[model samples]
Target: MPERDTIMRELHDLGLAAWFGGSMMGAVGLNPAAEEQGTEVDKARVASSGWAKWTPVNAAAIAAHLVGAAGLAVANRRRIAGQKGVLASTLAKTALTGAALGATAYARTLGKKIELASSPEQEKAKKAEKHPISVESAQGQLRIVKWAIPALTGGIEVLNSLQGEQQRPSRQIWGSLRRLASA
Candidate 1:
């Protein structure tokens, strides 16, 4: 752990930054803006289009973050195991990261559900989905789920900050000492 993992840290930070920013923007900016459209179909189309546009970039961000997180874990394995506070933060981060991923994927599924449900052609819709859900229902679910993404990711960011703090020389010294004492 003597050597710094600058690249990994950069990737983790930049990726999480984009993920958090994009989710917030979508929740506050894009979704509400899409709501101003004249019709439900239009709203769905607008929101879905915006999310679709961002999907690839978001995927890249998540991938980068996961890779960086793995790299960082490997780099700081000793600290994570030996430091008093680091293990708890690392476990919490891991759980939050998994939850965030699930929330993101679920949001996307709900988005697509509403988007397709908005189609006027009944036969086509039925063909696409055997039991197509109501647009209202799908949207209702989406409204709640979308907010979870930012919340979960934000929690992960806070955990990241705590991890950073734990790496400080003073914190490291105390954390290690505390770990040894507990043993």
Candidate 2:
């Protein structure tokens, strides 16, 4: 109801939006495109090249989301005392983010392996398949990362809502202070 509350709510909303948008783009847009492109050997090269080019953009997006989340956490710190539900949600989100980070790193490592071996001959492919370090593993890792993004993003949203609820009282306090000063 108070201005500070409104601002905190808006900050929480912004964090949720960034988390959702980044995760959806990574899952639905980037991962799918990479999969489709990686089907053919030449296409896989092109796809990897394209992804390499986009790495900075992806990193920027991720960094922005992390920064936003941290800001939201700071804003909500004081209000979390009476909001156990919100605190729980924030903790869950933090845990999910950490898991997603690990999964994402695993997926990237697998992708690099696939890229490095992109030019193997049929016999080499077969040999590699026998002790493969590419497609299947990469796909599995990507799948885990893909699902993780959404799960983590959704958790962030819940955390944001909880944050908003917790900050409501502080917002009122600030508003009351302003009103008293004005009078």
124: Cα error in model 1, Å? 6.6
Residue 53's lDDT in candidate 2: 63
Candidate 1 has its poorest 10 consecutive residues by lDDT at 124-133
lDDT tens digits, residue span 44-129, model 2: 56555555565566566556567656765676665443343555666777887686566556655665655555645565445445
Colliding residue pairs in candidate 1: none
Q: Each prediction's Cα lDDT score?
A: 0.88, 0.60
* Per-model TM values vs. the true structure: 0.92, 0.61
lDDT of 1 by residue, 40-152 (tens): 78898899889989999999999989988998999999999999988889999999999999999988877877666666778646643754566677788888988999999
* Most accurate candidate by TM-score: 1
